[model samples]
Target chain A: MRIEAGRASRRYWQDLWTYRELLGFLAWRDLSVRYKQTALGVAWAVIRPAFTMLVFIAFRKLAALPPSGVPDAILVLSAVLPWQLFSTAFSEVSGCLVGNANLISKVYFPRFLVPLAAMATSVIDFMVTLAMLALVMAWFGYAPTDKVVMLPLFVVLAACLALGAGVFFAALNVQFRDFRYVVPFVVQAGLFVSPVAFTLGDVPEAWRWLVALNPVTGIIEGFRWCLLGANAPFYPLATLTSVAITLAMFALGVWYFRRTERGFADVI
Target chain B: MSDIVIRAENLGKKYRISHETAQPYRTFRETLAKGFQRRRGSAHQEEEFWALRGVDFEIRRGDVVGVIGRNGAGKSTLLKILSRITEPTTGYVDLNGRVASLLEVGTGFHPELTGRENVYLNGSILGMRREEVRRKFDEIVSFAEVERFIDMPVKRYSSGMYMRLAFSVAAHLEPEILIVDEVLAVGDSAFQKKCLGRMEEVSAGGRTVLFVSHNLGTLLSICDKGILLDAGGCVANGNIRSVVKAYQQKAGSGEDLAPNLIGGPLKSVTFRQVWINGEKLGGSQFSPGEPIQIRVVGNAAEHLPEAVFTLSLYAEGGRLFTVEDRPMTLHQGEFSLQVEIPAGLLRPGDYSLALGARTAAELATPHDWCWGTDLASFELNEVWSANCKRDLHGMINVNARFTRENAPILERAAT
Candidate 1:
């Protein structure tokens, strides 16, 4: 082991690879801890998105919102699935550093693994919710179009967005701690702002660009398009914008996390 | 020649001590105010405390090096830097082997996880692979003496059991260089002895070890070399015996025995001087069963009724014995109190004195005036008398008298 000041980013990627087992263990620990004492166990993961889908279904009907020619429940679940992944991943990643302060202060590992592993837990939750969505579709006798094969690409996009934002917020939370309060607000506001309860087409055409700025908008609409068929339009321009923005966020988060990681043990 | 397993060059760690707010997490209002102050070029003053500064050392392979220092002496900081837990603010350290640090036992053990699961979790956290943990799993369980409870959640285990399990995992770690920080102080004495034995075994296998502990006797026994740190810098580095002796002499010197006055609501009384037998005392040696006198001189800022002064005596084994509270009314200015302890009571060991005072009205806050633990320490030595035996068992001398049951009084002999 060679330790030098201001050389954190030098071999960080290789170190992360070496510490990959830590990432797996951390993710496993988080998932186990989450469902350990709960009466429902892993059912809690599916219950959250299921309840969210039901609430959105009720809201869509009360608002008399126009549907995208698909079953309302399917439409809501598809959109809500990615949003659940994003929100959970964001919240877990943001709090990862402070939550594992003991490990950070006492042991040496690539700090990025903390937020990355926390994001992995949310990904696990997303997969469980996806399976639930599949069951709901089977009940509705809705066979997804051949486009469903393209869904993994969109899942990766959502994961990247969550990890990027989570890494950034994790670093900020260590210093300001005001970000802890800010994160919940962002996740809550994101529920309405992103195209979670409704399709991006339902958004007025003039303000659609503003919604596209939110990467999750592209992810939710993309999920719907893949699972519900082309009835959910795949706007190439909007998807490209979302992809570009998500990658930028990921890069910025990594840069900021590495910059602040050296100071975590000291300040934290 | 043995290879140099570790080398630290000019390592330093600096921390900003914020005085503006006591809270570690700043509020939004404070952050905003700080931003405004920064823009105006008038920021809050923060003192920088160098936990370690310009420390340099080299450890050869198979050397068991002990790190000795007083609290806040930067020993932990140096270990942290070497362990890569924190980056040094300056300089660097190079190690040529796999390094595992046990800064504390059970560092990442989850209370809710079972022993079987936690062993894996802790093993991985210590940088062990899955296969390594699996291979050594049985040994760890047996070493901890928790084979029957291995499947049970650690939260249900007693504290001793938990500590044993944690230490067992760390002991099984096969790092070429081990860094341990006072973790052997956990569990029972038998477990501590087992841990020390395990560490010696590790060192005997030609692996380098850096151990930090306040237990001077243990360090002297186990360490081949010692590094003494004082005020964030290395003061002495040499053979274990001399290093330990230097630390003890420096620690026992009378210069640092001055009482530290902590300001509070009841700051009316402050310690002016503390003396043993009319001499400043810092780890002074006294003969067993000899008459020892402690004189405490203090100043009262104002007239006070119901002022009670107490001197608490503490043995090295953490037993506390307090002198009777001397209640006295004091006018403004200086007052002195003398306490005498007849010698034959204490055994040959280290003892410390803590001074405290409280008013009847302020009984709730006993430390309001002059509370300092281990502020001045002295050692008791065994002195042989013509009739008294030199080697005695346990801490106090009773001077027992013997009598025969069916015979004469045996000349009324005392044993």
Candidate 2:
């Protein structure tokens, strides 16, 4: 058993590098396909959040909720920005396995690469949205806060959280196709549950812990707190949850994905 | 001992033949209970069918092997294992070099992409590097005869054009081992000839090839070694001709050719073994054009006479040139006819005979009773070539006069 494990591990290492080309190919293919026949092309990346920002502004002005960003401008832009990244990254990564049935069957690649490639392509969209966000911030003349130095760390945490959950959903999608439908619903619900538009202070004091337990809630609020410096760094606790959950979800996702991957070519 | 490139030991792959009929619209609870109960109670619910069992073989560098079998005979499954499309359920395989397969044309092609884009994508999928695809890119387009349509979208190309382009990319993209499955079966004869020439070039370049095809004639010319698989395992592994012979013999001997005496909806059936009669008829010698009794025995469960039928014979070489005629005039009962055996119709060889009984209609379902029993084995002991060399195209040999001035005129005027 010991010798077999050694050999298998060595094989896995070789396969990882050997399948790198496939990884790049899948990533490029997905990116090309996303904008292939579309009218807006790469601008769709900008349109989704830009329109969502407008909707948020209308809500903020109409309802008069306590403001997060620069009232009708920068605050809604920053909040909608991360929330869009979170939604797109996780969904694309999860849908990757089900989408590329052709590649999965004919070739031997690290199954994780399928979802990882989607996750990577999504970062391109994330970068574009981030670029747009910076422009929005400049337009509103919102200066950086001291906590802004820590914003990169929060973005990394959000990526990890998305990656970990993305892997699990990819595995589940293979076993049960209904996860495709479940994923959109989860993302929609997440938009409301996280403090995307409102401040966490609005929720009752008794419900604070339950609301903070949401990994993205902490990351989104952390994004606002670090960038704006209006709210306190509740991140110390949320960081613990995000890191711990990301680590656990990562390990679980890899294990589950590998276990189910053995049967993929045959069944798919 | 030309450096062995691939080796397999006790290689086997088993699949659970899922009887789709058994699983109905039952609930998950019911399915779980039934599955467990079936697993414990009856060993029959799950039948382990090994596509390949204990296959041990080695291929050296530059060897071409033809893996031949009937449908469901594990040919494709074995290719899948070697190509690493699926893992073997047991044992292991070791290979020293890369393997690529053209199992289906345009396998990795994106229809929305342009023909030029698909060429790169498909070429890479077959294990070719980008530089290699670029180097051979022009040659591939020219060979596929689709140079004009390179910029066009693949989805818009007709099926034939798509296949031609796909085949060109696959053939041009280099690999140490080329595994092709029935790709040559498509395309026009001229195009088939082109594909064969490309395969010959691949073989000459000292690359190993494993071609899976049902065309015995094609395989006999290309493959050096042959592997004949049946049901679950290799039955014969050796030279190409001998393996083909073994497969032919197995197919011929295993069938029950005799028509049932108590026939029903079956319009016209031959009771006697056609080949057995041919054997007893003084060993298959007939005057150039002679009258022969075409015998058939069947009862008219209901009388009808517009049941047109024809008896056909094909030599062991897959030649379908011989036919004994029974014109479209219905018959519903025990009937036999003496049809003329057109002189010089057959050449000297073993042949299998089959009979077809069809009713003439727009959407008529022809009652065909073809078998090893209806087979007529015959040989042409003498052929009066009559100052012309014989040809290798079709089944029947025809006799005609050639007038010098009219020859070219006839050729020009021919339909």
Candidate 3:
């Protein structure tokens, strides 16, 4: 490999692929260490979506909102799982770089793998909740239509959206510690702002497009529609907007991350 | 030629030091505040400092090269550039094969993970593939001597066991060109010897190695070539002996020598000066069996209770001995202390001294003391020693009396 002035090697991507096993190791380390001594262990993953489902149900009842034709339990859960995935992954990725300061400063690998691997723990947690969602659907006797095949695509979309913003903030957090404060606030506010607990239709007709500007909105809405079928019809224009914004953010995040990648070790 | 495995052309790394900010990273509010302050006509105090500049070198496929320098001489920057941990600001380095750097051991070892899990984790972090770690799993465990506790979390292991485990994984890394920092400074003497032996085997196997260490003896023994860096520039590069000689000369004389106050003073006690035999040491060389007198002068900012001064001697790869002076009370003023090492106490070898001062309250934390390692060094020349003909096996100098099996007790006692 040739290391040039102000640039990495010509085979940077190849270098990343050569170190692919590191991703698995790092991911495994995080997952195993996360719940090592905790009483609940992997059960912690199920608790969040279940708790969020209960809270949303109580919220809908208190507000006396009109429910879509689908059962409230499945509607809130299907959306909550994806939202949980995005938020948890987003926060994890943003903090991964700072958390592994010793590794970044001492060793050389594709630095992005640290944040990318961070997504795995959240993905595992999402899978746990996905299994819980299946159990809930079985309890409510609500199976999906053929549209369920599209579920993986929306999951990918949610992952891309999380990774994009997470990578961007991860780089930003290295330079300006203020981003640490910014990330949790955005993730928390994102739940109410996006259509996780409430459908995009709940917003006024004119503001639906604005609500869809949040990349997670389109992903959550699309995910819910896949699970609930005709009962949870999503606005096509909003989904397109969400997809566009997610892709754009992914591009912007990667561009910014690469641009600032070299300085990470020095500053961090 | 294809035999040349690593080459660098005019490599340099520059860092922008901002006097306005004391920390490496800046808060967003501080950045905004700086912008506003700049608009108010205050000048910015940013200076460009080159950590490594115009360093050019090449290494053949099997050369074992040592990088030697004092503090802030940019040895680390050069290694970091070669290791690809950081990019240089000017020029480039072309590495012919896979390069792995052990800047520190256990780079990514999680304390919460078991020893078995950490080996895999650390192995992959050091750039080994999973299959490679799996293949060497038993070897690493046996080398670390933690086979029985492999499933136990590392936090529960003794400090020696932890360091051994960490270094074992690193020792097994088989990159074509390996770059290592001073990771051997930890662990016991036996373990350090084992590590050095493994390194020698690596060099013998025809893989290129670049090592950085403060132990000159280890460097002279392991490396045939050396690069000496001074003030961010390569001053000497060639045969190991000559480069080390140049480094010694640079560190020994002129304005850089004597009474070296490294990194300024610490806490309330400011080390003002140091002297050897009533003269500034300046890295002087002394004959073996010669008494070395060292004097330390310092001033306390306030009344200090039970302040202890210590001087430690290090040789070969370990600290041989440490002597602590009596705890004395100082009433906020300058004071001088003298330590005399009588003749016949030191062998014919090179040794470094570490000076430390701490109060009783800070005794528990070793890092909290005002200390410096290799602060001022002296060499005991064998050629000039009276006991040069005697064969010595240990680090210290001690005389032995041998008696015949039938020797009379009265004759032995009279002698």
Best by lDDT: 3
**Considering only N, C-alpha and C atoms within 3 Å, which residue pairs clash in candidate 1?**
B289-B343, B289-B344, B290-B343
> Model 1: DockQ against the native?
0.62
Candidate models: Cα lDDT each: 0.84, 0.69, 0.85
lDDT of 3 by residue, B105-205 (tens): 88888999999999999999998888899999999989989999999999999999999999999999998999999998778888999999999999999
| Candidate with more favorable, higher TM-score: 2 or 3 | 3
Q: Score candidate 2 by DockQ.
A: 0.25
Question: Top TM-score: which candidate number?
Answer: 3
Per-model TM-score versus the true fold: 0.81, 0.79, 0.87
The digit string of per-residue lDDT tens for model 1 on B113-180 reads: 89999999999999999899999999999999999999888999999999999999999999999999
Question: In DockQ terms, which candidate is top?
Answer: 3
Q: Mark the regions of model 3 whose C-alpha exceeds 4 Å error after superposition.
A: B30-42, B254-279, B282-314, B318-349, B354-373, B380-415
User: How do these models rank on DockQ, best leading?
Assistant: 3, 1, 2
| Model 1 local distance difference test score | 0.84
lDDT score for residue A267 of model 3: 93
